[model samples]
Target: METMLITGANRGLGLEWVRQLDAAGWRVHATYRDPAKAEGLFAIAKKSHGRVVPHQLDVTDFTAIDRLSVTLKDEAIDVLNNNAGILPARKKFGQTDYDEWARIMRNNLFSYMKMAEAFVEQIARSRRKMILCMTSGLSSLSAAGSRGTASKFGDGKHVYRTTKCAVNMLAINLAGYLAERGVIALSVTPGWANTEMGRADLDPGYSPDDLVDPVKSVEGMRRIIATATIEDSGRLMRWDGSTLPF
Candidate 1:
């Protein structure tokens, strides 16, 4: 059976990914910042008959990451989904709070790099050889300036946008660096997902089910990842299965 280790598994898209992958028969090592607060996740894991294992992880804590790495050292992780991200309050240019921006960068970009560094070897030993980074359309420079540029669900904020852009660069850089190791690193934008970090409306005009359901996005991502080659690495892609410009 394939194995996936996902960060941020307590709620929203992360929780849904755990559920879907567990149901589909993959062994899931799902991490949450506060496992004690993860009652919903624990309930699902119980329902899954042990397919999901809740792990304690705070991405910003390198020591926590190292400890988890040692704990799972014997296991080969087939996929590493870098799904943890934060959206600090929005601001533009000089008005952007440096501290908040740095926090977002640390959580969304730096920690992602640290996680990949910690687990790349485990992934290399596995057969799937894929690493997926969750990114956003806001990461696309081409799309950033367009009118009606709000996220598909209508909430467009600058802090989230800038961090995702950084994430895109980090993923691409990893893809290039790991090319010789036969690992493919790619970024996927889950598109206007309906979560706390996403837009709040669930109108008929919006396909909130498709937008919010991490299962669908993940299944699509699986197909894309399974078919990936060195040629496909370092690309920014959408959940609808389309390529986006970096």
Candidate 2:
């Protein structure tokens, strides 16, 4: 069976990916931070009949990551889906929170690199050797300016955008290193999906109605992953398999 290890499977697009992949008969090692925040994930696991296994993971915790790596040491992780991230509050040019900015960078950017460093051997041993980073269109120099309406989103989220951009670069850099091991490491933007983080109050954006379906976006991403080859690595791609600029 094709297997995947996806972090941040508690809610939003992360939760959606868990549901879709579990339905498609893929074995999923789904991780979430808080059990209290994971009711939906636990419910899905209950119905998954052993196909979906849930692990408690805080990607920002390197010690926790190492422990999980030891726990799953013998298991083959085909895809390491780095999907855990935090949504930033609106911050104007002068209002950037340096502390919070650093926190987001650790959560969104460094954790991905740490996960790869820990689980790369498992990925190398898998049948479909791949590592997928969940990036954003905001990471792109050419694409960010055109993504969402400025009126709704305003000029904020500098930290979130910066982390995504850095993670994209990290994924590309890993591709170069892992290529010798036959691993395809690529980053993909899940688009502006109608998830909790993608809605108003999070960043004062549109309602769920204005965003793309999370399920549909994940479905497209699955297709992209299933067909991805080494040639596709080191590129920033959309859920629809289109390229995004760095």
Candidate 3:
């Protein structure tokens, strides 16, 4: 069976990925910041027999990542899903919270890079050497400037958008860097999903019908990841497997 490691597997999209991937027969190493709060993931793991393994991981902590790397050194990881991210409380340009902006950058962008660095060797040893980063459509300069359909999500989420944009760039750069090693790195947009963070007050306004279901979103993204080839490396793709403007 293929082995995959997913960060932020406690709830929302991450938990859904764990459930779906485990059901699909992949040996999943699901990491959560707080395992106590991951009762849903734990229950899924209990029923997974040995296909699902939950590990404690705070993506923001590089030392913890290093420790986890040491523990899984002998294992070959087919896919490293950099899925842990945070959306800070919104603030306009003039009222920007520098601390919160830094925090968001750390969780959303830097941590993804750190995870890739920590596990690149294991991914290189696998059959499908891939690093998938969960980005956002809002991060695209073209999508953000769209006045028609994209405007429905509202504006002024500078910190979140900026961090995701940086992550997209990071994925492209990682793709080029790892190409020689046959590791494909791509950034994916999960669309506007109705997750806890998606519905948070800081999030852009969208109706219940406008938001995609977490299960549907993860399912689409999983298909994209599963079918992605070396030619698709460094591309920014939507959940439906269509390419999006960078």
Candidate 4:
């Protein structure tokens, strides 16, 4: 059976992906920070008959990541989905919060790199051999260049955007390093899924129907993942299988 390791599987896109992949007969290692809070995931695990196992993990915890890596060392992981990340309140230009920036960078960027490094061995041994970092279209430098404010300075969410932008570059760098091992490394946007963060990304004028359904979003991303190759690596991809600029 295909094996998957996905972080932040307690809710939103991560949970949705876990649901879909588990139902499709995948042997999934779904990681979440808190077990008590992951009632949904726990319930899925209960009914999945050992296919959907939820593991405790905090993406920012390097030791925990290494521990989990060792635990799953014997298993060949087909897909390692770096889906855990944080999005906090932003500060204005001159009032930027350095601590907040550091915290988010740890979660969104450093943790992604750490996860890939920890699990690359198992991934290299798998059939699919993909490292998927869940990112956002809001991080697109190209979109920022073309749209947003009248100043053309880009949209806000300062700390979140910078970390995501940096993570996109990190994926490209990983692609080059892992290509020799037949690994495919890339970042992807889930489109405007109807999650808290997804809704937050939209403008105030948008409505409930404006957001992409999480099921459709994950399904499309899964299809893209199934077909991704080394040639498709190093590029940021939309859920619809199209590439986006850094």
Candidate 5:
């Protein structure tokens, strides 16, 4: 069975991914900032028997990441999904909170690099080397300016958008570096899903069944990660399984 590691598994999209992947017979190493707060996940793991294991990880901590790396050193991780991210509560550009901005960048972008860097050797050992970075459509310069649907989230949070934009470049650069080694590093937008940070009235017109529910989205992402080939590396993809503009 293929093994995978997911961050922010306590709630929202991360928890759903754990459920779907566990059901599919994948060995899931799901991390939460505090395992004590992951009651919901613990309940789900009870049902999964032993396929899922809860991990305590604060992605910003390099020491913790390195420690986890050593613990799972023997396991070959097929996919590393950097799904944990933060949305700014306030949206004014000049009125930004430096601490909040720093936190978002740490969790959304920097931690991804740290995790991949620390675990690259483990991923390299896997038969199918894949890394999935979850991104937002709001992060796209084209989508942000074109008024092509993603513009609904008005500007002001320069910090959040900038961090995601950085993630795009990070994926591209990493893909280039890993290309020769047969590793696939790709960025994907999960569409406008109804997560805790999303607004109430903003709907993508996708049905509840069709919408990017966290559980369904993870399954879709797993399939995409599984099918990745040299030809598909370095591309930006959507949850609908199509390439998106950088």
Candidate 6:
């Protein structure tokens, strides 16, 4: 069975990935910040019959990441999904909270780099060498300016957008750095989904009815991940297998 490790697997898109992959017979290492608060994931793992295992992990915690690396040293991780992130309330240019901005950057950008750094070797040794970072279409510079149309969603959300843009760059850089090592690094956008973070209140102008289903979104992404080749690496791709602008 293929082995995959997914961060932020307690809820939302990450949880769905764990469920779908486990059902597909992949051995899943699902990590969450607090397993005690992840009853839903725990139930899914129980039903998985040992295929899904949950680990307590805060992606922003480097010490915890180091400990995890040591624990899984003997195992090869075929895919490492950097899925944990925080989306703070939108702040206008003059109203920006520097402290919150820093926190978001640590969670959304720096943690991804740390995860890749800690697990690149393990991924290299696996059968399907892939490091997938979950990004957002809101990260697109082009999309930022074209918000008058119905297709466009987020307008401001400066912190979230900037961090996701950084994530795209990180994916591209890792792809180049790990190319010779036979690893494919990709920044994947899960699209606007009906999750906690995608609620109408959080992402104004888009209701749950306007959002894609989490299950369907994750299913598409899993298909994309399964079939992605080295040539497809370093691209910012959507759940539908189409390219998104960085």
Cα error, residue 218 of model 2, in Å, equals 0.4
Clashing residue pairs in candidate 4 are none
lDDT of 4 by residue, 1-246 (tens): 999999999999999988998899999999999878899999999999999999999999999999999999899999999998887775677888888789899999999999999999999999999999988776788686222352133345778888888989999999999999999998998886898777665565677687889999999999998899889888899898988887
Q: Give the TM-score of candidate 5.
A: 0.89
Once fitted onto the true fold, the runs of candidate 1 whose alpha carbons sit more than 4 angstroms away are 92-94, 145-156, 200-212
Candidate 6 positional error at 143, Å:
1.8
TM-score of each candidate structure, all chains considered together: 0.89, 0.94, 0.94, 0.95, 0.89, 0.94
Which ranges of candidate 5 are over 4 A from the true structure? 145-154, 199-211
For candidate 1, the 10 contiguous residues with the lowest summed lDDT are 145-154
* Displacement of the residue 202 alpha carbon in candidate 4, Å: 4.0
- lDDT of prediction 6: 0.87
Tell me the tens digit of each residue's lDDT in model 3 across 126-208: 99999999998778987773335545334668888899999999999999999999999999988777888777732344566
Q: What lDDT tens digits, residue by residue, belong to model 1 across residues 100-189? A: 777778899889899889998899998887789999877887776222533432243667777888889988899989989888898998
Pick by lDDT: 1 or 3, better one: 3
Which structure is stronger by TM-score: 4 or 5?
Answer: 4
Between candidates 1 and 6, which one is better according to TM-score?
6
CA-only RMSD, every prediction: 3.2, 2.0, 2.0, 1.9, 2.9, 2.0
**Candidate 5 lDDT over residue span 1-246, tens digit each:** 888888988888888888788878988889999867899888887887778888899999989999999999998988888888887664664677888888889989999899889888888898888888888776787656323553545556577778988998898888998888777898887765656654432435533443356655666776787677878877888776877787
> RMSD of model 5, in Å?
2.9
Candidates' C-alpha lDDT:
0.81, 0.88, 0.88, 0.88, 0.79, 0.87
Query: Alpha carbon lDDT of residue 187, candidate 5?
Result: 89
Evaluate model 4: give its TM-score: 0.95
Residue 134's C-alpha lDDT in candidate 6?
95
Candidate 2 lDDT over residue span 221-243, tens digit each:
99988899999888889888988
